[model samples]
Target: MKWKKGLTGMLLAAFLCGAPGVGIATPAHASAGEYKFDFGGGTVETGYTGVSASLSYDSARGYGFRTPENMRNVSASVRFLATGTKSENTFDVDLPPGLYEVSVTLGDTSRSSIAAEGVYQVINMTGNGAKDRFQIPVTDGQLNLLVTEGKEGAVFTLSALEIRQLSSNPVTNRTIYIGGDSTVCNYYPLDSSVQAGWGQLLPEFVNTNTFQIRNMASGGQIARGFHQDGQLEAIVQYIKPGDYFILQLGINDTNPKHNESEAEFKDWMRDMIRQVKAKGATVILSTPQGRATDFNANNVHNAENRWYRSAILALAQEEQTPLVDLNVLSSAYFTSIGKNATLALYMNGDTLHPNYGGARELARLVAQDLKRQGLSGF
Candidate 1:
């Protein structure tokens, strides 16, 4: 079956916390996601099954895949597999997509001298080691644990393999939903890179297969206009329990056509935040970034933008939700960089829209804020 677009690769990933299982849920030890085997036989948790390309499964002989070849990492008692080298053959565990942590115990419980090569897995592991835990991003696919000693043939012991669905709630991984104006729109192969929005660069920072960035932001959308156009409703449709909503609507709302009084803007944002939280999602509020100095100096749009920032700050304070404060960050960035350097990020000398350079910088700042906010799945 087709899973959600962002739910790709391995179902889950793990962050390296000293104690392990920091952000994700921890099941009751080995039982939640563990597998054991034997040469004379083996056993598995209720949800696990071993797969191999070499042999047919038989119930009497344990009805499953065997660890191939002279890579002796298996035993009949509390059997575990140590592996090295990327080989054509491997034993696989079939798993449905979600967040998961794989814990491999390296050696006998009494000994610790298990090491070689192959654990550095990018495409695959071509080494061996005793124990390591990884947050795997799995799709609707098989998790292949390779047990080999490569051509060099090193010896390693494997005992007690444990796998756990990190998130007991099963909704730990999430998507980042962005809602805003052109500033946050995913600018494509446009007239130029300068005609870019920060959203376009956002995906570059995230592992799309794990943390998907849905840039639902458009070229021109205010809170009221977005609602009237059904954009907000459409956004709400796919938002599940584990998701994020970054709302930045002030740029257009601060304009004449979509102008909202400070009080009105605050009211609208408050309602929007309330709606999002009601759906079991986290909502982050961002203020509109600054336009070029010349533009801010001459255009009525600047005053409107300022009003929006005020309202946004008030709303953030009132709700106690996280705030990106893009206005402050962008303003500081421009000030630090100075005019000529900053202008390079502006489009066609227009102070209003940022070019690709600016967008990327904006995205970097946004990503940093997300990390600090702990919205990032660690």
Candidate 2:
């Protein structure tokens, strides 16, 4: 079957005028817009019998000819014109609040995946898609088109794919900025060391197309030093209304040799919270991970370790900021797994830095906390 324009024609026309060979065939008076994206030369594994592909749409970018969705009006479909064999592929499309449809055609077979698509009757900022100025549900967030094949070797090829925006609503855009120590800095020279920080892994959990994640963390820097060195200034300047700031410290702050006292540390954290809030951005506090130590068994070693973990917790409660208690969470997991089992999570013999697994786990924990508080919507 030859591909025909469906809903997203106007948007596709605007996109095509900027690019050569692409064209929109729909009339100008049509209420909705239709878009077509060709994933030529894109190969799928046919050996995997259950593999699938999807269509995705990002207001910041464009549309994903491949993605899957269960919503009635929001979905995508693919037509396999040249098939080498018989195999099934899973298909999905993620769209914003707009209406969408998906139709899959395999040789002589065809199916209309979506029945109806449209816009929301009422809109508000806190609600989904309300923050978008256009009022069209097209997501400024990520629209993932995922294809999964059950078999490892199954492969397939596509002739064409379509994405339609059936609604007039626009999507919202938000940014999240990260600030912390070396544990969270953008580690480069990828192979230099195994030291990993949760900040590096935090972006994977977020929808970057809609929400921007900026990593401003530096290695081996304390809270006061970050502000003095202009890192904080850079972060503050970019922060706008409806943005978020994640402040993670304590790794370098705990160093007594640096002459950073607990009282001074607490003051620094408070100052950061005050300043970030002044910019109208939300603040999230994260505690430092625990060192591998047994307080119950070793009195001398535990007694001499003077970092005030409790003070940070107190500030979180006093300031009413969203807190992810990594120290407490990691300690609980460490205790449950026993000293030897937990060592694999940390990097090298040092108890402070974490390995890849540890960093991933920490990121997961923070994501869980964000979900529990329902703070991600902002």
CA lDDT of every candidate? 0.54, 0.49
Each model's TM-score, in the order given? 0.51, 0.51
Local lDDT at 172 for model 1: 34
TM-score of 2: 0.51
Per-residue alpha-carbon lDDT of model 2 for 116-183, expressed as tens digits?
Answer: 11211111111111111111233433223222121223322222334456444442246677778766
TM-score of 1: 0.51
- Identify the runs in model 1 with alpha carbons over 4 angstroms from their true place: 1-173, 190-194, 294-307
Backbone clash pairs in model 1 (N, Cα, C under 3 Å; residues 3+ apart or in different chains), count: 26
